[model samples]
Target: MIFLKLFRESFLFAYDALRQNKLRTFLSLVGVTIGIFLIIFVFSAVDTLKNNLQKSVNKLGSNSIYIQKWPWVNNEDSPWWKYLQRPTPKLREFDELQKRSQTALAVSYEISIDNRIVKYQSHTVEGAQIDATSHDHDKTWNFDFEDGRYFTEMESRSGSPVTVIGHDIAADLFPDGGAVGKALKIMGRNVTVIGVFKKEGSDILGISDDKEILLSLNFAKNVIDVQNASYNPQIVVRGKNGLSDLEVESEVRGLMRSIRRLGPNNEDNFALNKTTILSNQLDIVFNVLTKVGGFIGLFSILVGGFGIANIMFVSVKERTNIIGIQKSLGSKNYFILLQFLIESIVLCVMGGLFGLGMVLAVAALVKAGTDVQIVLDIKNIIRGISYSIIIGMLSGIIPAYFAAKLDPVEAIRSN
Candidate 1:
C-alpha cells in the first residue's frame, strides 16, 4: 500500500513538472531525436544499396564463377603501368581444367576494350565498350537478345566481322529503327550488326552492359591484338546448382596449378570471382557502419541521461522543505528515493518513445519514395526502451539517495 501511494505521487509529480516546462522538455529531447534519425536513415540507405547489388549479382546467375587476371569486385592497385611484369594465365589451362573438372557446366572466354567509337552512317558515339566473346558468351553471362539472334559458333570460329549491339548503342545508332543487317564502323573497322541486346541497369561496379558491342573473339583479336590473345583471355566458368561453389573453386585452382606446372610453394597467379563472397564482404562493411552509428547515437542518450540527472537534482534541492515535511509526516527513506527514481524513469521513457516515433516516420517516408527496405523490427524498439530505462536508473541513483538521506531539521531550516 505504501509502494502504491509512492508510485501515484511520483507519476503526479512527473506529470506536473512536464506540464510546467513543455518547451524545455521538448528541447532536451531534440538531441535524441536527431541521433535516432541519423542512425535509422543510414541503416535504410545502406540496406537498399546492398539489396540492389545482390539483385544485380543474382541476375548474372548465382552458380556462375569468373576467372580473370584481376579481382572482379572491389579490387584496387592494379598497377597497369607494369603490365609487362604481371604473369598471364593460359587458355590451355582452362581447357585442361574443363576436361578434368566434372562440376563445370560450361566455360567461355572474352576480351574487352573500353571507350571504343561506333559509327553508323552519319551518327557516331564515343566511349562505347567492345566485347569479343565466344558463341557461348550469351549463355554464360545470361545476356538476353532483344532482336535478331546471337552469332553462331561457326561465325565465331571463322572470325566473322559480325557484331551485336547493346540497347543504348542500338538506340543511339539506329534511332529511326531497322538496325539489323546494317554496317557499322567499330574503331575504324567496318563490321555488320547482326543483333541488339536488352537494356540492363547500371550496377554497383558501374558497368552498363547496354552500352557495349559484342563481336567474335577471333574478330576482336584481329582488330585489337595486344599479346597472348589466346592464352590470356578472360575465362568464365558455370557450375551446376547442386555443386558447391567452394568445391568448384578448389578443383579449378588445383587443375590450373597442375596444368601450369607451378612449384609446390608458388602462389596463385589467377583470381577466382564469386558473387556470394562479395555479398558477404559488403555485409561486413555495413555491420561496421551500423556499430559506429550506434556508438555515436549513444552519446546523445548519455546527454539526455545527464539532463535527467540535473533536473532531478534541482527538484530535490527546491523541495527540501517539502521533503522535511514528508519525513516529519512519517514517510520512509525508501519512499522518498522511489519518488525521484520514478520521476527520472518517466522523463527518459517519454524521450525514448518520442525518438522512436521520429525514427518510424522517417522510415515510412523512405519506403514511400524509394524501393529501399527499412524494417522497424521489435528488436530495435526493445533495445531503445531498455537503454533508456537503464540510463534513467544510473542517472537518478545519486540524486534519489541524497534526497532520501537528507535530515529533516537541516532541510527545513536551510531553505
Candidate 2:
C-alpha cells in the first residue's frame, strides 16, 4: 500500500512537472525518441532483406542439389581454370543418375538459352530469359501454374513445341487473359503456350518465375546444340521426402564420379551445389550488416542516455523540497529513490513508444510505395522497450540516490 501511494504521488508530480515545463520535457525526450527509432529501423531493414533472400533461396529447392561444370563459389583448391575445363552435365549423365540413384525422387537436365524475342501477333516481350528442361523438370523444381498444366511425358520425349510462360510474359502478350492455346514465336520458332506460371516477384538474387519462358529440353535440342558450353547445362536432383539432403548428396556425388569414369585418385570434375551454401553465405553477410547497424545505433543511444541523466539531475534539484517534506512525513529513503526511478522509466518508455510509432508509420508508408516488405515483428518491439527501461534505470540511479540521501532540514531550507 505504501509503495502504491508513493508511485501515485511520484507520477502526479512528474505529470505536473511536464505540464508546467512542456517544452523542457519534450526537448529532453527527443534524444531518446530518435535513439530508439534508429535502432529499431535498422533492425527491421536487416530482417526484411534476410527474409527476401531466404524466399529466393527457397524457390531454388532446399532439398535439391545441382550438378554443374562451375561451382557457385570459386574453389580455391581447384581454381576457375580447372572448373572451366570440366564438362557440363549432359543428358546421358542425367539419365544414368536417374536410373542408378535410389535416394533421388526426381532428376532433371536443364540448359539456359540467351535472351530471345517472344512475339504473339502484335505483342512482343524482349529480353526474356528462356530455359529448357527434361521430363522430370517440374518435379525437380518448385513452382505453380496460373493456368493450364505442365508438359506431359510424351510431349517432353517427342520434342513437342509446347511452352510455359511466366506471369509478365502472359500479361504483356495476352492482356485479355487467354494465354493458353495461343502460339508465340521464340527463337524464330513457333511454340504453343500450354501453361502460364503463377506470379513470383523478383528477389535479391534475381530469382523469380515472372520473367522466364520454359520449354522441353528435347525441343530445344532440335533447334540448338544443347551440348554446347555456351548453353550452361546442369542437372538438378530432388531428394525423397524422408531422406536428408546429406544422404541424397552423397549418393548423387558417387553416381556422378562413376558416370564420368573418374578413377579413385583423380579429382571429381563436376561440382555439387546446394541451396544451403547460398543460405550460409547470406547468413554471414547479414550478420555483419546487423552488427554494423547496431554499433552505429549504440552511439546515438549513448548520447540519449546522457541527455536522460541530465534531465534526472534537473528533476532531482527541482524536487528537493518535496523530498524533505516526504521524509518529515515518515516516508522511507527507498520510497523516494524508487519513486524517482519509476518516473524516469515512465518518461523513457513514453519516448520509446513515440519512436516505435514513427517506425511503424514509415514502414507502412514504404510498403505502400514500394515492392519491398518491411517487417516490424514482436521481437523488435520488445527489444526496443527493454532498451528504454535499461537506459532509464542507468540514467536515474545516481540522481535518485542523491535525492534519497539529502538531509531533511538542508533540503527544506534550500528552497
Candidate 3:
C-alpha cells in the first residue's frame, strides 16, 4: 500500500512538472529521439540487405559448388588479377572430374556467349546473354520450364541446333505468337526454339533471371563458331547426398590437379567458388555495419540523458520552497526521490516511444517503395525500451539524491 501510494504521488509530481515547462520537456527528449531513429533506421535497412543477399546465394543451392577462373568474393591480396594470370579451365576438365568423382550426383560446364543478336520474323533483340550448358544444367540449377521441355542429353552430345528461350527473350522474339517449334536466328545462325523459361522474380542482388537464353553445349560452340578445344568452361559440381561439400570440393581439386599435371608445391591453376563462403563474408560485413550504427545511436541517448539531468537540476532549483513545504508537511525523503526519478523516466520513455514511431513510419515507406524486406523483430523493440529506461534511471540519480538530502529549514529560508 505504501509502494502504491509512492508510485501515484511520483506520477502526479512528474505530470505537474512536465505541464509547467512543456517546451523544456520537448527539448530534453529531442536528443534521445534522434538517436533511436538512426539506430532503428540503419538496422532495418541492413537487415533487408542481408536477407536479400542470403536469398540470392541460396538460389545457387547448398549442395552445388562452382569452379570458375575468378573467385566469387574477391580479396585484396588475392584479386581477380591473380586469377587472370592462370589458364582458363577447359570443358574437358569437367568431363575428367565427372569421370573421376563417384561422390558427385551431376556435373556440368557452362560457357556464356554475350551480346548476341536474336531474331524471329521481323523482330530483333540485341545484347542477349546466351549460355551454352550441358543437359544437366536444368537439373543442376533447378530451372523451371514454362511451355516446353529442356534439350535432351542426346541433343547436347549431337550438337543439335536447338535453343531454350528466357521469358524476356520469348516475349521480344515471338511477341504475339508462342515461341514453341519456332526458328530464331542467333548471330546469323538458325536455331529451333525448344523451350521457354518461366519468369523467376528478382534475386537478392536485385537481378532478374528472365533475360537469359540457354543452348546445348555443342550447339553453342557451333553457333558462336568458337573452337571446342580452346573453349574455357565454368564447372558446376553437385555432390551426392551424405557427401560433404568440402569432400566433393577437395576431390575435384585433386582430379583437376592430376589432369593438369601441377607440381606438388604449386597452387592449382583454377579458382573454386562456393555459395557458403560468399554468404559468410556478407554476414560479417552486415554485423560490423550494425555495431557501428548502434554506437552512433548511443551518442543520441547520451545527449538525451544529459538533458534529463540538466532539466531535473533546474526543476530542483525552481521548486526549492515547494520541497521545503512538502518536508514541513511530513513528506519522507524517499517520496522526494521517487518524484524526481519518475519525471526523468517519463521524459525518456516519451522520447523512446516517439523515436519508435518515426522508425516504423520510415520503414513502412521503404517497404512500399521497394521489394526490400525490413521486419521489426520483437527483440530489437525490447532492447530499445530497456535502453531508454536505463538512461532515465542513471540520469535521474544525482538530481533525486540531492533533492532528498536538502535541509528543509535552509530550503524554506532561501524563499
Candidate 4:
C-alpha cells in the first residue's frame, strides 16, 4: 500500500513538473531519443540484410553439396595450377559417385551452357540463361511450379526435347498463348515447354531469380560437348534430414578418389562445396556490422545519460521547499528518494518510446518506397525499452539520494 501511494504521488509530481517547464523537459530528452533511434535503426537494418542474404542462399539448397573442378575458397598449401590442371567432373564420374555413395539421398548434374533467344512462333525472349540438368535436379534446385509438372526420369535419360521456362521467359515468349504444352526453339533445336516456374522474388546475390530455362541433360550434351572445360558441369549431392553433411562429404570424397585413381599421397584435386558456406560468409559480415553499429551507438547514449541526470538535478533543486515541507509533515526520507527516482524513470521512458516510434515510422517508409522489406521485430522493441529504463535508474540515483538527504530547515530556507 505504501509503495502504491508513493508511486501515485511521484507520477503526479512528475506530470506537474512537465506541465510547468515543457521546453526544458523536451530539450533534456532530445539526446536520449536520437541515441535510441540510431542504435535501433542500425541493428534493424543489419538483421533485415542478413535475412535477405540467407533467403537468397537457401534457394540453392541448404542440404546440398557441390562437386566442382574449382574450389570456392582456395587453401594456402594447395597450388592453383594443380586445381586448374585437374580433369573436369564428367558423366562417368557422376555415375561412379551415384553407385558408390550410401549417405546421398539425391544426386544431380547441372551445367549453365550459354544465353540464347527462346522463340515460340512470333514471340522471342532474348538473353535467357539456358540451363541443363538430370532428373534429380528438382531435389537440389527446389523449383515451384506456376503451370505444369517437371520432366520425368525417362524423358531426361532418353534426350527428350522438353523444357521448363522461368517466369520472365514464359511472359515474354508466350504472352498471348500458353507456355505449357507449347513448342519453343532453343539453340536452333525445337523443344516442348512442359512447365513454367513460379516467380521468385529478387535476391541479394543476383542469382537463381526468374530468368532461366531448364532442359534435359542429354539434349544439352548433344548441342555442346561435356569434354570442353569451358562448359564443365556441377555435380550436386544431397543427404536426408537425419544424415550429417560431413558423412555425405566423406563418402563423396572417397568415391571421387577411387574414380580418378588418385594415390594415397596425392592431394585432393576436386572440391566438395556446401551451400551453407555462403550463409556462413554472410553471418560473419553481418556480425561485424552489428558490433560497429553498437560501438557508435554507445557514445551517443553516454551523452544522453548525462543529459537525463542534469534534468533530475534541476528538478530536485526546483522542489527543495516542497521536500522541506513534506519532511516537516513527517514524510520519510525514502519516500522523497522514491518519488524523484520514479519521475526520472518516467521522463526517460517517454523519450525512449518516442525514439522507437520514429524508428518504426522510418522502417515502414523505406519498405513502402523500395523493393526491400524492412523489419523491426518484437525482440528489438523489448531490448530498446529495457535499455531506456536502465539508463533512467542510473541517471536518477544520485539526484534522488541528494533530495532524500537534504536537511528540512536548510531546504525550507532556500531562495
* TM-score of every model versus the real structure: 0.69, 0.94, 0.84, 0.90
* Model 1 Cα lDDT, one tens digit per residue, 26-100: 666565555555555456556656767776776665777777676655446665444445455555665676678
The residue pairs found clashing in candidate 2 are: none
CA lDDT of 69 in candidate 1? Answer: 70
Which RMSD values do the candidates have, in order?
5.6, 2.0, 3.5, 2.7
**Which candidate gets the maximum lDDT versus the true structure?**
2
Please give, for residues 268-378, the per-residue lDDT of candidate 4 as tens digits: 889888867767777788788878877766566667778878888998999899899989999899898998998888877887888899998998788788757876877
The predicted structure with the larger lDDT, 2 or 4, is 2
In terms of TM-score, how similar is model 4 to the real structure? 0.90
Query: Across residues 47-95, which tens digit of lDDT does each residue of candidate 3 receive?
Result: 6777777667666767787887777776667766667787766766777
Better of 1 and 3 by lDDT: 3
Which ranges in model 2 have alpha carbons more than 4 Å from their true place?
Answer: 1-9, 12-27, 75-78
Q: Which ten residues in a row have the lowest lDDT in candidate 1?
A: 80-89
Per-candidate Cα lDDT values, in order, are 0.76, 0.87, 0.80, 0.83
**Tens-digit lDDT track of model 2 for 1-415:** 9778877876776677668878878887787888788788888988898888878767777789999888787545758888878888887898899899999899999988867889999999988889999999888888899999999999999999999999999999999999999999998899999999999887778888888999999999889998888989999999999888899899998999999999999998998999888888878888888887777666666677777778778888998998899899987899889988887877777779988999999998998888677988789889988888888888788989999999998999989
lDDT assessment of candidate 3 = 0.80
lDDT of 2 at 346: 74
